[model samples]
Target chain A: MLAVDMAGETVRAMNGSMVAYDGEMTFKRQGMTGGEGLRGALRRRVAGESMTLMEVTGQGTVYFASEATEVTLVELAGDTLLVESDSLLALDGRLQTGVQFIGLRGMGTGQGLATTKVEGQGTVAILSDGPAIALEVAPGTPLCVDPHAYVAHRGQLQQDVVTDVNWRTVLGQGSGESVQFRYQGHGLVYVQPAERGGILEI
Target chain B: MTSTTFNAATLPANDNVNPYAFSVDLNGQWFTQKGKMIAYYGQIRFQALSAGPLDMLVAESFHSPLYAHDWIVAEGQGKLLLADRGFDINSYDLDKGNLTIRAANLLAFEPGLELKQSIIPGFLTLIGTGRFVAASNGPVHFVEPPIRVDPQALLGWADCPSPCHHYDHGYVRGVLGAARMMFGVGGTSGEEHQFDFTGEGTVLIQSSEHVTSSDAMLRELEGQIGMLGVPGLRQLHGTIAQRLAAEQQH
Candidate 1:
């Protein structure tokens, strides 16, 4: 659960995620805008990366929670944060929510081919199955992350699918972790301790 | 509370990054269960136990053929992170000692420890030395027995004899008690049956009783059923039917 103290500012949160509030507050559905106008809404529908948000405006303090999932807040300073739609919980109303094509790497992980893009300045709350660990990806030290455990990534980084497939894979003796997200460059990647069940479980 | 970040240079070597995740400083090889690895930093390669070059290592340390498909060998150098369904991750060290643990809870074990199928179905025994990681639904509690534990809460036991099933059917004594037992009248306390442990050594139990379903255990049970003849199967069928009926009544 997260408590936000608002003197009079507004915050965009996941729809129906407000648990309780004190003082005065008004929640209005973000509607078709999808935080990127009609074009963004259409792109979301086509990409299957839609996220429903509600605008909460008013005063005092408000508590927000969703399914009791662990929440971690990421503050952005005119940079981009790419996250899964479902892992997005709440964000500052000023932050721009958009969509970006991440190619077919998300196909095997079952997270889809596009990712939710949060840019501009503000704090963004992302949900994870457990506490999220932030790993730094540098030029020399690249990181290999299981796609199922990936939550989000920020900064200038190159993401690619690394496959270690061999004859053993065809013999039903493949290492369960045959595909991983290889991240290089300079950035931070967030990963939960738990791996979500994916098509690769078989 | 999300400010702390770790790079390859700072990540702990063979320690936990958090209570729910473990970081193994991989220099050579480690045996891990399928789908337990979450992430890693540096150069590492994963291959099935049946992979060509690992045959000697697999034959030396891994003795459970039933679980061969579910096991893999992680080789190379790096920090390997592992977790299981967000369970509380913990590492146990055994120096020339043996420990038997529930199959589903055993996440990853080092190659130095020899793995074998326990005589008790659904459990695996690790002999020799080295370290292994396990997960529990909650924090694990260690208790010495001379005690009876709910089977669902049992995680593992070290230096102890295998437990036997103890059914305290004391309620079915008098005529009314017999009627209750026979007709399922008063219902059960759900605590009558437990794994009774004796002698020395420590028994590990989780704080919660939610047991993660083990496919390996189910397969083990299926294998044991082959030993039963037609008459035994018939008796087992009757018992399962009664259980189903009793479950539906609830």
Candidate 2:
């Protein structure tokens, strides 16, 4: 659970995520486009990265939690954070949310063809099935991760879907580690310890 | 609580990042169960146990032919992270000692250790001096022998002889009890049987009684099914159908 001290400032949070609060507060459901006007709404609908955010303004403190999952707070300054829509919990109202094409990495994970990109300066809280580990990606040090365990990533990193097909896989005795997402360049990748089963195999 | 961000330089070398994750300082090779790897930094290559290049290494360290398909060899240099379904993960170090763990609970181990299939149907034994990681439904409790543990809660035992099945025959010896056992009419307490261990070694049990799905058990049973003749196979099918019908009625 995350508690935030509010002083009349508004924050964007996942709809129906508020668990408890003290003092006076008001929550207003965000529009279909996430307050990005008609054009942004159209893009979100087209890209299938739909997010239902609510504007919360209050005086004392407000608590937010979803499904008792662990929450990680990330501070961003003029950088882009690419996260799954279902994993996003809450973020500063000043941050911009948009859809970005993420290629075929989402093919097997059932997360759609695009991911939610959060940009600007503020703190964002993301949820994971378990505690998420942040791994560094640097020059000549590429990171390979299972698609079902990937949570989010930030910075200038190039990602490619790496498929390792061998004769055993063709013969119906495939090892379960055939597909992975390879990340290179400079960035940080967040992965949960457990895989989101049913969406992807291996 | 203030959260710390970790990079490749900051991540631990052959230790746990947290209770749910373990990081291996992979400079050489490690045997990891398939799909347990969450992420890794640096260069690491995962090959199936059946891969030809790993034949020599598999022959030397791994001895479980029944579960060869469920394991893979991770080779190269980097920090490899492993976890299992978000279960509580802990690393154990064995120094010239042997430890037998439930096959589902065993996650990954260094190449220095030799792995063999335990006498128990769903357990594996590790020998030599190296660190291996295992997952449990909750924090593991180590207790001395002369204890009876529910089979579902049994994680593994170290340096101990295999346990024997103990059943409460007194509770199921009469005519009514025999009828309940045969037709599944009356409900048993589900605790009529347990694994009784009595020795001078440590027996490990998880706090929670939840057992992970056992795919290896199915494979083992399939392997043994080949021993039956055509008539025996037909009889087995009839029994399975009757059991399924009973289960659905409940």
Candidate 2, residue B91: how far the Cα is off, in Å:
1.3
Q: For candidate 2, give the DockQ.
A: 0.69
DockQ for the candidates, in order: 0.82, 0.69
Model 2 chain A: ten consecutive residues of lowest lDDT:
A168-177
Consecutive 10-residue window with the lowest summed lDDT within model 1 chain A: A193-202
Q: Could you tell me how far off, in angstroms, the CA of residue B82 lies in candidate 2 after the best superposition? A: 0.6
Model 1, position B84: C-alpha lDDT score: 91
lDDT per residue, candidate 2, B1-250, as tens digits?
A: 2256677778888888988998888899999998899888777888888888888999889998998888888998888889888899999999999999999999999888999988778899999999999999999999999999999999999988899999898657898888977766676788898999987999999999899987999887887789998998999999999889978997
How well does chain A score by TM in each candidate?
0.97, 0.96
Structure candidate 1, residue pairs in collision: none
lDDT of each: 0.91, 0.89
Write down the lDDT that model 1 would get.
Answer: 0.91
